[model samples]
Target: MTWWPEARDELARLWVEDTSRQQIAEAADEIDRVLAVDPEARGEPGPEGFRRLTIRPLTVQFAVEEPDRMVIVVTVRLLTD
Candidate 1:
């Protein structure tokens, strides 16, 4: 599993903006749950060729590169209303 720059930035931004340690813990737990999944089972079909997982207010976008057997996290962002 690998995180793209945008995913890292978004996670950083979320941590900075939300000072509650509990919130951070929750997010971290959710992220870990997602990561622990088998790459083949991790993603649900998404637009174009991507796949996505929902973690509450955030949506984790990713792509499965079968040849490499790796999951590349494309981005993490707040869900729009």
Candidate 2:
């Protein structure tokens, strides 16, 4: 799975710094939920056809390229800074 730099960094930080197995598991579940869906119906569409999916405490930004059969996760972030 590809992740934007921020998302990658955050996940890495969580794994190393947070150390809460439940929280990490929940986040993983959220990621799997997003990947399992037909995003067009699951998330709000954004500019250039990007989609945003909110999983409590975090928002996942992604884009789907139909022809290429790709779901590119653009970023992941908290609901608020």
Error of 2 at 20 (Å): 6.6
Residue-wise C-alpha lDDT for candidate 1, range 1-81, written one tens digit per residue: 788887878777887886554655576568656766775576587887888887665678788787876777788876545
Score residue 11 of candidate 2 by CA lDDT.
61
lDDT of all the models against the reference? Answer: 0.72, 0.67
Model 2 spans > 4 angstroms off: 14-21
lDDT of 2 by residue, 1-81 (tens): 356777777766665665464666586577756766676676787767778877665667777767754666787665443
Clashing residue pairs, backbone N/CA/C < 3 A, model 1: none
* Residue 41, candidate 2: alpha-carbon lDDT: 72
